[model samples]
Target: MEIALVGAGAAAVGLLDALATTSLARVRPGLITVFEPSPHLWRGRPYGPDLDTVLVNAPPAIMSIRHGDPGHYAAWLGESGAAHLDDLLGQPLVPRHRYGDYLAATAEAALRTLRANGWRTRIARARVTGVERRGDRLAVVAADGGRYAADQVALCVGGGEPRDLYSLAAAPGYVHEPYPLARTLAPIPADARVAVLGSGLTAVDVVVSLAARGHTGPITMLSRSGLLPHVWQRPSGHRPAHVTAERVATAHREHGTVPLGHLIGLLRAELAEAGEDFDAFAADLLAAGTEDPVRRLRRQLRSVGDPRIGRRVLQETAHTVGPYAWRLLPESGRARLRRHFRLATSVASPMVPVNAATLLRLLDAGRLTLVPDVRAVEATGGGFAVTAGDSAIHVDAVVNAVNPPPQAVPRAAGELVASLVSGGLAAFHPAGGVVPADPRVQVAGDLAGGGPFITSGIPGIAAQAARTADAMLTLARDESSEAPATLR
Candidate 1:
C-alpha cells in the first residue's frame, strides 16, 4: 500500500505513530510519504519554535498525540523535564518548542519502525496543491509541479492562521500574526503601547509573553465580547459517571437521536453525584463571560483549589463525549449549542493558572486592560485608535490575536479544497471541513467535518489519526485479498 500524508502536523505524527504501532505484519510493506512546506516538520504551526513564554496551553492529559495512551507524553517528559513545571497547575507547562521536540521524536521513532519493517518513508518539503484520482490510484500534486501516487491519502492540514479582522495587514505598526513570537514580537518595542485584538488564548499569549519580555508599556486585550478564557484548575482526575460515550450511543439507539436536554441531564447528574448544584453552577458559568473581567479572574484563581469536581467533569467530558454527542444531536440541539458557542469555548479552552495569575498581576499593576464590545480599530496618524463600547484608546502597535473561525480552511488549502470539490473527490460539510467522497481519501485534525466547532485539541486529533490509520490499513488488507499479485 502506498500512503500519502499531507501536512506534517500533529495529526500526521499521530497517524504515523498509529501505523507503526498497529499490527501490520500480515500486510505487505509499502511506501509512506509526508508532505509539509514548513521547515519544521511534525511540529505544525502551534508547536513550532516560538518564544519561551509561548507554553503549551493545555494540560499533559489532553496533549497526548497517541490516542488511548494518556501517559505517552508525560512519560516522555519524565522527572528530569519537570524543570518547566507550572507550580500553580501542578503540571509541567513546557514551552511550545519542547512539545514540538516530542512530536519530532515520535515521528522519527515511527519512521524507524516502518523502515525496519521494509516500508519506505519520505518527507517531501513542499506544499500540496491538490489530489486527483487517477486510474485506481490517487495523484498528489505539489506546488512545484511534483506528483506522487498513493493508494491512500490523509489530509492532515492543521488550522488556519489568525484572521486579520481589522484589515490591518498593510497598515504600519500592525502585527498580522503573533506567531514565532521570536519574530513577530522582536520588532515590537519594549515600551510600545500595544493593543491585542482578541481575548482568547492567543491574546492571552501576547499579554503574558510581553510581560515575560519586560514589555512595560500599557497593553489592551480587545474583543467584541470582552470575555477572557476561564483559568484552568489543577486536575481533579474526576472521570464522569454519566456522560460516557456508551450512554450517548445508548440514547441514540433508543431515541433515534439524542436531545440537548438529555445531554444536559447527563451533566447535571454527573455534577450532583459530586455534591454540586447544576443550575447554580450552570448559571455562574453562563454569566462568567459578561462579568467584570478582574473579578472573574480573581474568583477563578481562588477556586483553583476549591476541591469541587464540577469543572473537572465538564472538561473531561468535553473531549470524550463532546464529538459523539455533537454528531448525534438534533438540529435544534446543535443550534442551541451554537448560540452560546463563545461562552462554551471559554469554559472548554481555559488558560493555565500561571497565565491567569500573570494577567491578574498586570491588571492590578495597571499595565494591562481588558476592552470588551470592541467597535473598530482604525489606523491613526501616529498609531491605531481602538474603540470599544464607550471607551477608546490609542496604541502604538496592534497585534492580530483573533483566532480564525473553527475549521476555517487556510488560504493556501482553500484553493486545494476547491480543486478537490470541483473534481468530485471531496465535499464540504455544513458543520466544518471537507468530507471525503472517495473511500481512499481520509480527513483528520481540524479539517475533518461533522464534529464540534471548537477545534479539536491534541486528544481529538489523535483519536481521528488512529481511526484514519486503521481505515487505511483495512483498505490495504482488502486490496491485498482481492489482488494478491498487487502486493508483490
Candidate 2:
C-alpha cells in the first residue's frame, strides 16, 4: 500500500508524525510519499525562516504536534534551547523560524521511525495538480508531469494567503502578504508612513517587527472592527469541569444538536466550578470590543499575572471541545457566532505579553494609531488614501495583514480540489474544506472542513492528523481483511 500527502507543511508534519507513532503503521508498513514544492518542507508559509521578531503566537503547551502530549514541544525546546523565555507569559515564545526547525526535525525523526519499520518514505519536492481515482487506487498528478499512485491520499494543504481586500496587489508600495518579515520588511523604507490593514495578530506582528527594524515613521493599523487581539495571560493551568470534548460529544449524542445557549451554559458552569463570576467575566470580555484600544492593551498587560482562570479555561477548551460543539451547532447558532466573529477571534488568538508591551509603547508614543471601520484604501498620487469611518488618511506604504477566511483553500490547492470535486472524487464542505467522497482520500488541516471558523492551531492540527491517520489505517485494515486470498 502507498499513501500520498500533498502540501508538506505543519499539517503534513503532524500526519507524518502520527503515521510513524501509531500502532497501525507497524501492521501496514507502506510506502509514504509527501509532495511539497517549497524549499522549506515542514515550516509551511507561516513558519518559514523569517525575522527574529516574528514569533510563535501561542505557548509551547498548546503548540505540540503530538496529540495528547502537551509537553512534546516544550520538551523539544528544553533539549534544543532554541527558544527564549517570555518572562511575562512564563513560557518560551520562540521565533517562527525556530519553530520551523522543530518541525523539520520532527518530520525527519518520524521518517526515520517509518523507515525502521520497513515503510519506504520519500518527499517529492513537487506541487500536486490533481488527484484522479484509478479503480480502487488514487493517481496523484504533479505540476511537473509526474504521477504517483497511492492506495490512500491526505490533502494537508495549509490555509490561504492574506486576502487582498482593496485590490492593492498591483499598487505601488503595497504588500499583499506580510510574511517572512525578513523579506517583506526590507523593501519598505525605514521612515515610510506605513498603514497596516487589519487589527489582528498579523498587524501586531508588523508593528512590532517594524519597531525592531528601526522603523520610525508613523504606523496605523486600519480595520473594520479596529479590535486588537486580547493579550495572553500567564496560563493558570485551569482544567474545565463541565466544558470538555467528552461533554460536548455526549450532549451531541443525547440531543440532536448542541444549542449555542447550551454551550454558553457549559462555559458558565466551568467558570462557576472555578469560583469565578461568569457575568463579570463575560461583561469584561464584551467591553473589550468597544473599549479604547490603547487602554485595553495597557490593562491587559497589567493583568498578565491575574489569578482569574476564566479566559484561560475558555482558551484551553476552544480548540479541544470547540470543534465538536461547532459541528453540532444549528445554522442559527453558527450565524450568531459569525456575527461576533471578530471579537471571538480576538479573544481566541491573543497576542503575547511581550508584543502587547511593544504595541502599548508605540500607542503611548503616538507612533502607532488604530483606525476603525475602514471603508476603502485607494492608491493616490505618491501614497495611498485610506478611508476609515468618514476620515481619510494617506500613507506612503500599505501592508495587507488581513487573514484569510477560515478553511480557505490556498491558491495552489484550489485547482487540485476543484479537479477532485469535478471528477466526483471529493465534495466541498459548505462550512469549509473538501469532504471525502472516497474515504481513502482524507484531509488533515485547515483545508479539512466541518469545524469551527478559524484556522486550526498546532494542537488542533495534531488532533486532526491523528484522526486521519487512524481512519485511513483502519479502512486499509478492514479492506485487507475482506480481500480475496489471491489478491493478498
Candidate 3:
C-alpha cells in the first residue's frame, strides 16, 4: 500500500508521527510520500523562524503533537534544555521562534523513528498543483510536471494567502504580505509613518517586530474595532464543579433557559465543591468539547426566556469553552464576560499591559503616530500618497496589516485546498474553516463529509492525524478479505 500526505504542516507531522509509532509491522504502507515546497516538511509558516514576534497564543504545556499529554511540550522543553523555555514559561509571553524550534525538533525525531521502522519515506520539494481521482488511485500533479500516484491522499495545507488591497497594491509605498516582515519593510526609511490594516494577533506581531528593529516612526493600527488580542495571565485556581452531565441536564430541566453565565457560576461552585485544581479542570473541559459551547449557550438562551436562567447558561459555557471558541463569542458577549471574570481569560491576551506599555513608550517618544484612518493610496511622483480619513499623508513605504480574504491559499500548502474545493471533493464549513472527513483532521482542508482529515490548530490536528492513521491501519487489515474501493 502507498499513502501520500500533502502540506507538511502540523497535521502532516502528526500523521507521520503516528505512522511511525503505531504497530504497523503487519499493515504498514509500502511507501509514504510527503509533498511540501519548503525544504523542511514539518516546519511550515507557523513554526518557521522568519518572524520573531509571532508568539504561540497557547501555552507550551498545551501545545504538543501528542494527545492526552498536556505536558509533552513542556517536558520536551526541559529535556532539550533550551534557555528560552525558562523565560517563556516564566513570563507571560514566549517568543514565537522557540515554538518553531520545538516543532522542528519534534519532526526530526519522528523522521528518525520512521526510518528506523524500515518505511520508505519521500519528501517532494515542489508544489502540488492538482489532485484527481484516477481509477482506484489518486494522482497528484506537481507544478514542475511531476506526478505521484497514491492509494490515498491527505491534504494538511495551512492558512490561506494574504489579501490584496487595491489602494495599497497600486500605491508606491505599500507592503502587501506581512509574513516576510523584514523583507517587506526593508525599503522603508527608519523614521517613517505607517498604518496597519488589522488590529488582531498579526497586527500586534508586526508592531512588536517594528519596535524590536528600532523603527522609530509614527505607526497607527486600524481595524473595525481597533481591538488587540488580550494577554495571557497567571493561571487562577478557580475550577468549577457543576460541569457534570447530570447538573447540566438538571439545569435544563428546571429552567427553560440555561443562562450561560449562571451555568458558569454553577460549574465554578461545583469545582469549588470538588476541590480540583482550577487550571487542570479548565484545560480538561476545553480539550473535551468539540462544539462551540458559547454558541450552544447562545442558542439555548434564545430558545428559553427567564433572564436569570439565560445568564447562568452563558456563564457556564463561557467558563468551560476553549480560547478559540471563546474568541468567536460576539463582541458584546466578550465585553460582558470581561466585567465578570477576574481570572485569566482567553478572549484576548491577558498580557495586554506588556504590549500596551511597549506601544505607549514608542508613542510618547515620538516614535509612533496615531492616524485617523487609511483613506486611499495612489502613486505619487517619487513615492506614494496615503489618505487618512480626510488628510493625505506621504510616506516612502506602507505595510498592509489587513488580513487577506479566506480564499487564495498561501504558500505551497494551500494549493491542495484550492484543488479540493474546485473539484467538489470538499465543501466549506458554514462557520469558517474547511470541513474534513474527520472532525479531528481535515481532508484537503475543506469541509466535506469524508475521512482522512485536517484541523486548524496543533492539538486538534495532532488528534486528527492519529485518528486517521488508526483508521487507515484498520482498513489495511480488512483489505486482506475485502477489496477496497479506489478513486473512480
Against the hidden true structure, what lDDT does model 3 obtain?
A: 0.56
Looking at candidate 1, what is the lDDT of residue 327?
A: 88
Tell me the tens digit of each residue's lDDT in model 1 across 1-488. Answer: 78999999899999999999998956789899999888988998899888889988878887889988988999988885679878888888989999999999999999999999999999999888998989989999999999999899998998877877888888989998788788888888999999999999999999999999999899999988888888888887777779988889999999999999999999899888888999998989888766898999999998887788777777767776797789899999999989888888888889999999999999999999988889899998699998888878889999998887777787878878887888888899987778898889898888888889787888778888998989989988888878857544
Task: Give the per-residue Cα lDDT of candidate 3 at 189.
Answer: 76
Scanning candidate 2 in windows of ten residues, the lowest lDDT window is: 21-30
Sorted by TM-score (best first), the order is 2, 1, 3
lDDT per residue for candidate 3 within 1-488, as digits (tens), equals 67778778776777777777788755644787888888655767666656555556555544677654656677767744444332312423356567766676776777788777776788888788877667766678899988898766777666666566545566667777777675666676768777666655567667878887777777766543333444333333233345544565566567744455754566567545555344564563343233332232233323332222222222323322322233333445445544533222223222233454565566566665545345566667665666667777776666676654432245554566666667655555543455543222235322222211112445555655676778766766666346544521
Please report, in order, the local distance difference test score of every candidate based on alpha carbons.
0.88, 0.88, 0.56
Could you arrange the candidates by lDDT from highest to lowest?
2, 1, 3
Worst 10 residues of 3 by lDDT: 446-455
Root-mean-square deviation of candidate 3:
9.6
**Model 1 misplacement above 4 A:** 485-488
Candidate 3, residue 368: lDDT: 57
Candidate 1 lands at a TM-score of 0.97
Supply the TM-score for candidate 3. 0.70
